[model samples]
Target chain A: MSSPLAKPQIIAHIQKSLNYTVFDSKWIPCSAKFVCLGNFARGTGVMQIYEVQHGEAQLVKEVEKPKPIKCGTYGATSLQQRHIATGDFDGNLNIWNLESPEVAVYSAKAHKEIINCIDGVGGLGIGDGAPEIATGSRDGTVKIWDPRQRDTPVANMEPIEGETKRDCWTVAFGHAFNDQDRCVCAGYDNGDIKLFDLRNMSLRWETNIKNGVCCVEFDRKDINMNKLVATSLEGKFHVFDLRTQHSTKGFASVSEKAHKSTIWQVKHLPQNRDIFMTAGGAGNLHLWKYEYPAQRSKKDSDGVDVGVAGTVNLLQNVTLSTQPIASLDWSPDKQGLCVCSSFDQCVRVLIVTKLNVV
Target chain B: MTAEEFVSLQNQGAVIDYNGKVPVEHLDYGYIEKCKDVKYLEKILKVLRSGEEGIYPDLISFCETRLELLDPKNRLLITDKPVTTAASLSKDEWGQIVDDLKMWQEESKKTEDSLKHQPLLNDIIKENIPPIRGSNQSVDIQQKQNKNHCKRPLPRDYQEWDKFDVEKECEQIDSNSSTTSDTPAIVNTGLSKLRTTLDASFLAEREQLNLATREKDKGNEAFRAKDYEEAIAYYSRSISILPTIIAHNNRAQAEIKLKHWNNAMKDCQRVLKMEPGNIKALLRRATVYTNTGRFETAAEDLRTVLKQEPQNPAALKLLSETELKLQDEGMIKKKRKGKKILIEEVDGDDGHNEKRQGGLKGEIFWVLYIINHLSHNLYNT
Candidate 1:
């Protein structure tokens, strides 16, 4: 609902409690349905599909497996298929068909330990390239998978044989402007964010924010490199200007501290790139807007060019549940519509009123 | 547009009165559309049209766009022309500029041959440019453009997503032999060669096997507690998960204890087909046949069991009973005097030994399970 004379507001549209402990939730594209991923108390991974019907979340389908699910992505699947690729506690990657869901569409043993985060690109008509999924796991590796290939990842990023492996916590795909231009940003628990160039199969840029990174996301998946927002385990979040990267220094970034606790997730509004909402560990949601600076790049010392950082302003803040909100996603087709999962075992549908005006 | 509507919306807690004041110009399009008063729009349109052209250019265009939908005649006159200026001008110069504008528009229309690829309808106005998705640049739009075929299925199955041959991929793994640490060697799904590889399908298979074994153990537990019906049910569940000769034989033994002679016979046939000349299956089937009064077949099965294991006391005792029944039924000539002595000796400890055999029957499930497990290990090696 729009409050035309008033400013935009965040409204809790629907809240439903689940039996299992929810770890992640995502909105399915072009539909009113969303998927909730979690583990039952008895150690079974449960994937529950719910559709928003009559202002209520209706259970559409439920599937269970032997492992606990950690993360999932729809970016590697076409709109017609509507498959979900998920990572589980057993280090197994499985793509499921929502229709039958009795067997996986494709499966692979992608890692030796739990997979922490997964992102995908080149699907849903978003990118003009091969649809590939990138998964970062506790095994200290980032692997890219193509559903066309069975049982093996198409690309992998890892350390040398004997080096101590840092746990990879989050991953996201950006700069997918065309078939040849794609990059994967993987955040590790050791405060490192590595930008891997998929076309060249090399690490392009990397830097640490001095705190464990909890989540990373691009403003839009189809456009050229523009902005990336990452939240930390501490009460800090950084917004990086992906348009420019200096030779010695990495991309310029602006950091902000809020919520006074862990910032669990940061999701940009699907209809507006400049606006994003961060879910906090103390059961609060803070909305922020990024304002571009006058000049994006200028000559630094020694006549070398360096990038400029933008400023962020808080739009609103509200407390919903008294537990950490682990995952949040804005609906692809509906502006200001979102679904979030929290440690309170609740999945909530929210309407951030008047996102267009924001 | 209306004071009453504004007050109602304000009371509804959506809009707030800033410092207890309301401004007409600050109200957005959604609020105005909700009011749906045409006179309110008309009043604003009249004021915009009468104002200075440059000062109200945006409002002038907005009013024309909205009003043209209500009046089609005004639409023809509102085509692509700049708003008329209000400043005083000499008649001759104004006429000259007007004629120049018309001539340029006519020349552009006549010179259409210069613009190739006419399908791209580019608007001269910068604000009228369509979004990238509307420009047929995205992949899905291009696909939908050329499609004259039937629609793809909704919520496609995984098999519909790609034409990937899984067995062929495994075969390629065999030929290439490019084994990296993380890139596992994916073997054929049906082949037991999957045991050494930590493939996901193999893990899924092992998970099923563990569940089946658990069911089998529960069946054995039920059998120990003298719940033959529940034991048969659990055995059936285990068989449904993964068919094993041991499970069938165990189920057959339970069915025989329940006096389900026909079901026991069917289960024994299954075990025998899986492992031909199996001594336990032969003995169980002979017992079933003897219970059902098929003395000839029982004798034949017992004879086969004795040939495999001569010290099989259960088979020997059953054989003597079968022969005695055959003799009573007149199906056998009672002329072998040595056979009679052997039968008498086999029947000597019949009552006490039968109870001992029945006690040993309970251990067969564990023994068969261990044997099957060992055979599996041997196969993997």
Candidate 2:
């Protein structure tokens, strides 16, 4: 086998120094464009848009807002008409059109504390053509928003107050529906993965994984296989099965000493659902592959052995920087390309490949 | 390319031909303004620009000094760039430009003050500190290596791997499985458990939604029974489950009965933002504004209502009350000409510090008193 222990290839480095720390980044679904948010020099919150043309990243737009931007995600009609949605420290959420370069069409105060993560939740047939948005906040709440209505949230799932209000760190929606069923999962500071079913306003499942859950993702295209992968602060990966009414099954140690800090974000490739990448606070990103157990019985009531239902092997580990990675977002269409933001006040696009052929 | 080469190109481009392509907001204007700490900020800024292009992690340090000079209450208004004159802008456009800038500056300050309250900024600062690499030859070499590290492009496909070995490993796993080692029963248990838990969550969501609807229906029933307070409470509860303009509007009607003008005003404002053309919200806001003595704002809201419904007697009444208030005030048109005083001398008095400290205590006392007064005012309002 080609040695999977290879370093990711760096394509372009964006050298612009943000006056404030960058909180998150998102790739515009189909294009080589990306948007990021941070504090501007004036201490006011600001967002910048960048486009990767040929090989270089050129700054396309910079908009000044009122609060420090904590997280940003891109949404589109079908990966062509791009829109950027940003969550700020003051609970203000703004969704902007990349083409207009003017006022944000959708704006509202969504949370009390900083919005830790903002994800575009697709596959919800909510009548309104506008995409629904999901946001995780330090206030220990996950909210669902529709762009058409700005002031009030469509739905809010707050953690039981008496229990530890673990600040939600990240959120991802599983478009990979099993039998036309989709779900959304949010990772919390206390390492809890709570899946929410949008079709019905209900909590799907909650698990207490020892470490703080930093990132969680479900396979995008593979619908029948209800699989979930969660990365935690303790450098451990937990894969859960939503089909089976039993114990959760998969655990993969991709980078034991690869990152000196907690893993910040993880993303499954849109094109290849089996391949996934995780960004660590130690400025390292590790990729892994899950090989299904061959001896496993045929699809049971617990459903088929999904991609993450068995053993996982580390493929490549690349050192990004010393700065803790704040967030990592993969293009829903692109195969290997990804965008990562960090405390280093930089966002870089990296390419990974096999180091050597066996 | 090396870090040095990258820096030279960036600096050369910045110095010679300004790439207006990089928005003024995105430019590392901090480096330009705070040139005193050139080495540190420059290095950090370089790494950020070359790596991410737009996101900056160390912007807090740059804003620390500026943030100190501003007032917390008025921070949003004060942080505006003291307007500038451009040759491209005509003399007639000056007044509008200055007004626009001032408006945005105030807006920006409000945004900044809100940002200061976020928890993540504090976390980011605590977590992401750039490894302080001092000015050394080795450091320069490392910087070059770091630049190259992030500049590599990602692979497109399975870099068509040497599948021969992977196939062999797969064959090994396949043949070994035939020997029949015990399958981890834990896996099956965990999977089933997950499935059950997921189903429970879906059911719980439906139950919650149903409860919300029930609460909302109860509120409507109370409203129909003419029990305004009970209706308000039920509506509030329903809004907690799912906030809608109708609920807020219903609550506003109850507030009107209770004569809670300010609360009604707030509800009306919220509904207006959600549904701009809401006639009830507009009418209620006009009444609240008039009652609160904000005549101009009251008149504006009433005008909007009247425009939509020309025969709106309620809107006309509110407009008349606002106009009456405006007639009494007669606009304070005398503009205070502030002195352009310049303090060129630096104070050498240590005694000045003592005086300042004394004033600081008094100011603190005043601020505390003001906050308490404001809280009372808010409560009463």
Candidate 3:
């Protein structure tokens, strides 16, 4: 009931020219360097690695591929290796060694169509299990790949023969670090979100938002299942509490209207789990904070413990340009420092001050 | 000064000699008295005592401009009290005041009720329902008749739909058709059976082979598109349907694109077993072996390919690269041995005792060494 806290000030540090339509950006693990993947005017994908130097993004390395890259992640492999796994429009998944950018160290044809999203887990020296990557494609299938196994995927999720195939817009890995158990959460174009358990090889849970879901992300990849934020079309996003599950009602969730247009992506700060930022189709960036309930679960009439959902509070918003922000990444080593790419063919390095206070 | 004297001096517009040596200005007694009631005189006196003479003339003018209203008699006229006589009071005035207060309270209560019960404007405007006419009257009459009718009694005999035998109907149809038909039907049935047997034996294998080729063609299309994963899948499917050297060789190429060294090597091996003269398979297998640190095997494969095609540029280049890699590997081995000997010498004295004492540092050094070695290997590869 009380008014939310005063919004934080977003200070734009440096706006760099990408000269291409940037589709995705990701920060290298344990470094100030970040990678931006974009498409050139000729339709080829270009990956540029930039380092944050004196409030400016300095281009460190650039590699151009024959196909357009849709997404990339650094979570699957170890931080020491610094291998970046990327999915391309040609359905090829490739892992590049940062030291050698001329060619990928590992590559595979991962899907039948363009890969819409990719995520990785069990890396960063946090878990005992081997690192794995999950990719969702426009072909309507989500496949999990262990890089050590080169010939085929470790697991594949496709529609049954009689069922209609839906485009998978996003995929995420969660509940991975502490235990060997891991689950892949995928978002479909039909508003369906499915959580597939890798250990049991079955769909653990599924729910629909009645609107196309664009992106799905777990709060932290190296922790147990804690929270999930899913962004959808029509300017809405939902936060689900994963600590408790009900028999009839699944994980408790609360929906909130974010930007006035579609939210393209939502990324939680690497330093703070409760804080996250959403990039909107209207080129607006909104900072949000999740407030957890004092008691996560309570007994129902049937004596079953039901999860109590938390609330999402808007903290700040800033409009950088007129074009929609396609992708953004927060530096894992530096607090409040982030890089985001927009449809305007420019990548901006921003610093959100006073985030440590939140 | 006395009130009478102050008024007499003000009328004369002259000074009053207080001590014969200094003359003090006469003040308006009425104005002074009015100022005292409002506490303005005390503020003016405080200002005067501070010796700020610049504000004195303004204060004096303010008093003079309002001299008529400041008259004591005029003040008394405006301050008159209401008359206490009963003749001046209105009849039932207290009752009327109470009634008005109650009426106001009731009006506020009505407003509060309206606010609580008011429907949304959109909902109110959207509601439009027409009254039901003759159709409802007929339905009501029918319902009334149905209610008046008595319920039927249960029958003792019961029949189940599942009790009927479906085969008996088919048998009756078959008997009727057979009786009407003759030798032509039997001949047609016999010929169809023979044709089915012949197709099963001769065409099945060829059909499977055709399907495999189709799958292989799909794999080739995917490979051209650079979708090596799909190509690999298609090629695998083709191999599963009917094992062929072409499918295996194609899968190996896709695997090589993916940098699946072990898988590519296995595929190449399968192809070479089918046709030992496959130069493409040999070269691909040699590249895989070179990537996986099997230099000797890679050299052997390159030698075989060079023998088959002496003028092949790809094979020639790969052979030179393999030789350079082998030399580098030899140097790395020598360096590792040198480091191992140095470590051995450092811990040679009281071998068991020194090892226990320096184990932590040694382990840390080994980890750093291994990391450095691995990074170096990665750069060369």
For TM-score, the strongest prediction is 1
- Tens digit per residue, CA lDDT, model 1, A221-268: 755566899999888999988766776666889998866689989998
Task: Quote the B-chain TM-score, candidate 2.
Answer: 0.31
Cα RMSDs, all models: 34.1, 33.9, 36.0
**Alpha carbon lDDT of each predicted model:** 0.72, 0.58, 0.70
Instruction: Point out the higher-scoring one by lDDT: 1 or 3.
Output: 1
Tens-digit lDDT track for model 1 on B231-308?
677688678777788788999999999999999999999999999999999999999988888989999999998888
Put the candidates in lDDT order, highest first.
Answer: 1, 3, 2
Highest DockQ: give the candidate number.
Answer: 2
After superposition, candidate 2 runs with Cα above 4 Å error: A2-19, A75-80, A123-130, A160-164, A175-180, A247-258, A295-308, A354-358, B1-381
lDDT of 3: 0.70
lDDT by residue for model 2 (B1-381), tens = 999867855764564322233334434554434333333333444445465555654663443333333322221212212112233345555455345434533543443344334333323322322221111111010111221233344554665554447778689879766654334332322111111101112222333344345445545544543445656675676577667788788889778877789889889989989999798898888777776777788788888888899999888877887898777755431111111111112234346555455555555666799999999999998
**How many pairs in model 2 have backbone atoms within 3 A of each other, for residues 3 or more apart or on separate chains, i.e. clashes?**
46
lDDT of 1 at B17: 35
Q: Which pairs, if any, clash in model 3?
A: A109-B229
- For model 3 the local lDDT of residue A160 reads 65
